[model samples]
Target: MKGIVFLGERRLALVEVNDPTPGDGEVVVEIKASGMCGSDLHPYRALQDLSRPPESRVIGGHEPSGIVAAVGRGVPRHVALVGDRVMVHHYHGCTVCRHCRTGWPQLCEPITRTTYSANAHGAHAPYMKVSADTLVPLHDSLSFEAGAAIACGTGTAWGGLERLQPRGDETIAVFGQGPVGLSATLLASTRGSRVIAIDLDDDRLAMARQFGADETINAREANVAEVLRELTGGQGVEMVVETSGSPQAAAAGLQAIAVWGKVCMVGIGGKVTVDTQAMLDRQITVMTSYTMSTVAQKSCADFVVSRNLDLDRLFTHRWRLDQAEDAYRVFDAQVSGKGAFIF
Candidate 1:
């Protein structure tokens, strides 16, 4: 099996390794497509800082899609059978936790959940071992690349938008034009909500229009809050989805919405400073979220298929497993859009 391992200085290598075998209640998947997530860079950036290498090597991909190669004893046949196409939910929780009991195992209390690329082996390899419980069925109509995207970017956006519940009568300002933000723009528009997409790059903003943004604002060119204010007739939009994770954008997005508006933050970045007095005066509702659960993962795939969304457009770059290093290099440099490694 061929896999990627990070060796500091933002470098990675393709190495030959033994194939993974399924553990009890687990499955070994032959990975077909794996998404290169923005969040994957966090570990790579800090791996060298540790006194000693944490694991054999750092493997950083989380969004995984594949065909089941083998299933372990006690695994549910109906859920993950050999040769079945599926996406693996990156988060693996302690099944007995309260949060896991609620179907959102990813948010287990006391944080006993283990995720890909952090503590466990990730899907950047040709084969990955995952819990059968984390498998989500991939419809024949959806491509492997799209299934991989659902593992993270698309799933995160879908879950956040579903929580915000954008309506036709409402207007939403999606603060970012990256994969997650673009997904938000497309979903919000398909739901009939007027969408205003914001970004610092002209190219991303242009792509946002392709995703169904009614208005585009380059944060570098103009005041984001001011532009959004004018677009909404001074009352401001009813909703704001901040996927940039920029501290300034975070604060501006929350303050740009109409009184009592809803704001959902999906991006994980610098700290954001908020005004308590202003928040109280406006009675704002702010929510911070991450990836969806395994159940929600299935629902998100269905949501994309039901809307007939072009998840393909989000994947602007694709490479083979051997090209892993170059893929992450450009992605980390912010020179690429949603990317994937096809086996």
Candidate 2:
């Protein structure tokens, strides 16, 4: 089997590797499609420190969709079939911990293991293994590309919106035009919130409009906070989804949030400086959201099944496993609109 290995320092290589066999409570999946997430770029760019040395290369992807090939001993046969198409949670929690019991595995107790990017080998290869607890069955109608996205990008948006709890009548400002940002805009609009999308790229802004943004702001040309303020009649937005991950964008989002409003930080940007005094004075609530829970992932999957989300539109480009290097280059340059690797 061939997999993409990250050798650190912005280095990625496609190399042949041994296929994985499932262990107890785990299953081996035949890779179908893997989506490149914005968060994946952090490690690709060396923004996050590697937990291990460079010599111990790790498999590079997490957002994968595949068909169940085999189940390990002691795994329940009813959980999945040999031919079932599914998506993995990408991260599993220690079922014994308080957080896991309460349904937040991403904050697993002890926090030693993570799917794909950490201790476990991720899905950047021909085959990968995952715990049955993290696997979700995909409907026949959903594409592998769509299923791949459910692991992170779409799930993150769903988690963020769940935290913010945007109402039908309230307005939401999504400050970023990347895949995750666009996913938030689309989901917010579907929930009947008026979505305002802010981004520097015209292409992404146009896509945001297509996804249901009531208005789009070209942050490079105009003042984002002022535009949002004017759009909200000076009261500011009822809720702000900060997906730009930019320090300035965070500050602007804080400025554009209505008093007592909620701000959900979903983007992975540089270190930001916030005006704590102003936030306290305005009585605003700021929260951070990460990966979705199994329950939340189920909800998101249901939403996709019910709403028939336009996953095809979100899949702007596709590459084969052999094209992994080129794919990273395009993603690093932010050239491909919404890219994925198809087996």
Candidate 3:
């Protein structure tokens, strides 16, 4: 088998390795779709010290959806079976921990964890091995690519929206038209919120429009806070979801939120300065959401199915495993919609 390995400094290699066999309570999945997330760029572009090689060479992708190919001892039929379609939760932790038992293994209390694509092998190849607990059923109604997106990017958007709780009559300002932010526009619109999609790129903002944004604002041309304030009749939007991770955008979101408005920060980035006095005077409530839990991943899929959402529209590019280099080259530009590897 050949797996993609990031060699740091924006370089990657496809190295040959032996096929995996599941161990006790584990299963091996035949990869059908693996998504390319913005977060992947962190490690991809990180500068490495040549003197100190990485401790381990982990696979490169985290958003995985596939069919069960094999199951090991102690894995029950009720848990998984060969040929079952599934999306991976992507994190493994001690099963006894409260967080793990409740579907948030990433927050395992014991601190014992394995995050696919980071510490353990992931789904960048034809096969991936993982605990049966990480499998979240992918509905037959949704495409494998959709399942892959739900496994991470889309699920993260759902988690952020769950935290934002935008109302039907209110307005939501989503700052970023990337995959996650674009997913939020789609989901929040279905919930009846008037969505104001924000981005520096016109193409992505156009994608957001197709995803159901009520309006689009190119931050490059205008003041985000001013535009949002004018859009809401000087009161500002009712809610904000910041997915760009830009310090300027984060600060602008805080400036553009209505009094008592809730803000959910989803993008991972550098520090941003906040106005403590302004927050206090406006009674603003700000929160942050990481990726979704396993249960929430399932719920996200259910929502997509129930809504009959055109999640497939999110993909602007797709590639075979062998096209890993070309795929990342295009995705690294960061101006396009979602990209994935389809097996």
**Predicted structure with the largest TM-score when compared to the true one:** 3
Ranked by lDDT from best down, the candidates are 3, 1, 2
How far is 31's C-alpha from truth in model 1 (Å)? 0.5
Candidate 1 colliding pairs: none
Off by over 4 Å in 2: 47-55
Error of 1 at 59 (Å): 2.0
Any runs in candidate 3 off by more than 4 Å, and if so which? Answer: 51-56
Per-residue CA lDDT of model 2 for 1-343, tens digit only, reads 8778765566677767678989998899998988898777777777434675543677878897999999998778788779988888888777768877665778888774466556788888879988877788887898899888887888889999999987789989998878788888889999899999988889889999999999999988999899999999999998988876888888889989988999999888656778889889889999999878878887898998899787768878899988877788887775346788888
Winner on TM-score (1 vs 3): 3
Candidate 1: clashing residue pairs, number = 0
- Report residue 247 deviation for candidate 2 (angstroms): 0.9
lDDT of 2 at 4: 80
Instruction: After superposing candidate 1 on the true structure, give the runs of residues whose Cα lies further than 4 Å from its correct spot.
Output: 50-55
The TM-score, computed over Cα atoms with residue i paired to residue i, of candidate 3 is 0.98
By lDDT, who's the top model here?
Answer: 3
Q: Write the per-residue lDDT of candidate 1 for residues 64-148, one digit (tens) a residue.
A: 9999999999997798889999998988888888788766877888788878777788899889998887888998889999999
Using Cα atoms with residue i matched to residue i, what is each candidate's TM-score against the true structure? 0.96, 0.95, 0.98
